[model samples]
Target: MSLTLEQRLDTLPAGAEVAWCGQQYVTAGQLRADVATLAGWLAAHPARHWALCLDDAYAFTVALLACGMAGCVAVLPGHRRPAGLEEQAPYIEALLVDGDWSSAVLSFPVCHWQAVMAAPLSAAPTTPWPAPLSVLMFTSGSTGVPQAILKQERELLAEVEIQAGLWADALAGAVILATVSQQHIYGLLFRILLPLRLGLPLAAATCTTPEQLQAAVRGLMRPWALISSPAFLEHLDPDLSCPGARWLVSSGGPLSASGAALSQRCLGLSPVELYGSSETGGIAWRQQHGSDWMLLPGLTLSVDAAETWWLTSPFLPAGQRWALSDRLVWQENGFRLLGRADRVIKLAEKRISLDEVERRLRAVPWIAEAAVVPLEIGGRRCLGAVLIPSAEGWRLHATLGEGRLLLQLRQALRPWLEPVALPRRLRCLSAMPVNSQGKRPYAVLKELFDVAIEC
Candidate 1:
């Protein structure tokens, strides 16, 4: 059997220093011992399945490793609220909630993570004995309620191989520092899983602030790459100026050419983009300088009747042709992403296509980030914008839509955007919110606007 992730951990330098913040150093031996101590405690709660809410990278990584070995799935319900998601948590015996969102639900035998280490030291379960599904990510269910996607142990391994093989040269012996969360797939693969799977050193510092990102990079040595989301990348032109960073890999949303060009200008490197979904791991990818994806090696592709590309790969079960939600423009041996099939919306007898709006938004000067979401106001359709301005747009939010800027907006969009597709509600913030995977959680955005915006 292939060396399991834990067994493979032995291949790294046995006592190599792991610096999470330059303050905490745990050698490989110490890490193993810590997990043993922690897992020792977890054994006491055998009757309760864990509903985990771990946010930090190092803690999340090590804890997950321990949880997997302990056979207690550290279930991630994928919702911010506890009880709402917990009420439906499958096989949930109890909760392991974070203090900020923690509810009294823990009163019935809930164990804080600290209690886990004191339970019992069950020797690491024989490595890789068909590891159980450790992750449970929720999604928009078919009937419009949240649903969970069960991720198997081997699937995470397969993802590591696909990315490491495809981007092998960039990743060989390189360390990863990320602003994304460990609970989500994009961050899990690029930030936490890949490095651990390869036995490489990882920066424990989960850089959440722009300053933190710069600080994390400055503290690291060479061959370090930033695993970030489009929102994070779009916000930081100054932080990208750090000469220490070797490369950046951005996903979770589309990165516009302007943003990529800005990054290349500030940092010597351009952010490489990944294309994939929660369903089928990373399928194809392109660099800021490339035009189309160099599809993942060995994936089979055929066109559907509608001309969208249908794909199959060894990562998936045999003969399963995966139909993607995103449209594709297939070439003789390549393809380009056309928009997502579900992103289009209708407006006053006119269809406001996402591709059309995206192209127009990109043409606007200094419009660093834009999400043209269509929402209904009193049953009448309208558009909303959450814009991240370029440096020049720093002072304009309070003055927008009142006088000169409003005129400028109309002039900029007049020829292209149909009136109905024009943003009826314009909200500007210093930065936008991104979820675990780097995708903008639209529902969360609505919350940000709840107090300040009125349609």
Candidate 2:
């Protein structure tokens, strides 16, 4: 049996490299020492809950381990925006940061890792974390306010077991380089815990841009695995080449087949996309070559009357099951995702799928991109569309007024959709509002119709 992460960390060889930041390398001894010092400091100043808000992945790992050591719950927010942090401040007693906090105005006590590292180090503490030690993770549900998801120590360990075994040979001896934020669950597992447990080196800094990614890939001459998201993979420069990569993983959103093919051409391996939510750890995975997603090991899946998936997995507590948002159809070996349940809404006493509306709209000529949303106008719920038009769409919009263009779109959509499903309000924009995770910001998209628009 594999040892638990905390136990594995205690046995790691001191001289082995744990992380690389630029040209500098951090060894296991250095990491252990930092974690020890932080744990010591945290032990002295106790809190019920601490927020780990570091931007640096390496620093965040140390802080997280220290929190575990000190028996304090760490709240990992989806983003570090001042407004967001302000909302989360009530739950946290203090904040741990290694990034810029200048813009964030918080009432909670703030402590930096530098202070902890600079503090006198006590003998390394070796207390195993409690089985029920809970960590809080926030996810931006379509409703907008972040929803907190609790993850216990057991669930995390189970995930490590499943993921480590799944990619053992592919990631054996290879370092981890990631473009995704470690604050998210997927990144936390792939970029930090997996490497830490397996004793593989990880890159300290997150590659935020394509240039940084290229530089990091080139800088690490050894074989490496990349943890990324569709947002990053979809925009990969075709000319950019990194040949030594053993594997690439994407999560948080879907990657187009064309995007995956282009990435496979540039990188040596095609990206493997993992599908899951913050509430339920990783549920399934798929590669670009396949259309269906294979459930992670030890997971039992079933579909409800509405076709929504319900899963029972080791990642969940005993005798517990999770209902997923995705609608899927089971195959012999795996499942194919249809769409999200939340994307369906009721309009005029009829069920309508927002995805279906967008699909039919995109099928029309000159429509480059389409997002259909239900909006409330003068106390009535109606369909609204935000579009990114092709060159021809722009020409027509310019020739015909906005009202006329919308009428033409409605006429085109009438064949596929009922009058109630057709968009009552339409707006054209150059681009949609996308978050760092590469998902369309539905709340922001809805706001376009919420306010008065002349066009």
Which candidate number has the best TM-score?
Answer: 2
What is the alpha-carbon lDDT for the whole of candidate 1?
0.64
Where model 1 places Cα greater than 4 Å from the true spot, the runs are: 17-19, 97-101, 104-110, 114-133, 141-143, 238-240, 306-308, 317-319, 343-455
Candidate RMSDs in order? 12.2, 11.3
**Alpha-carbon lDDT, every model:** 0.64, 0.79
Score candidate 1 by TM-score against the native. 0.70
Residue 437 Cα positional deviation in candidate 1, in Å, after optimal superposition = 38
Residue-wise C-alpha lDDT for candidate 1, range 158-251, written one tens digit per residue? 7687777767676665667787766567777888777766666677767766678666656664667788776566666653556666668887
Clashing pairs for predicted structure model 2, backbone only = none
What CA RMSD would candidate 2 show? 11.3
Which candidate number maximizes lDDT?
Answer: 2
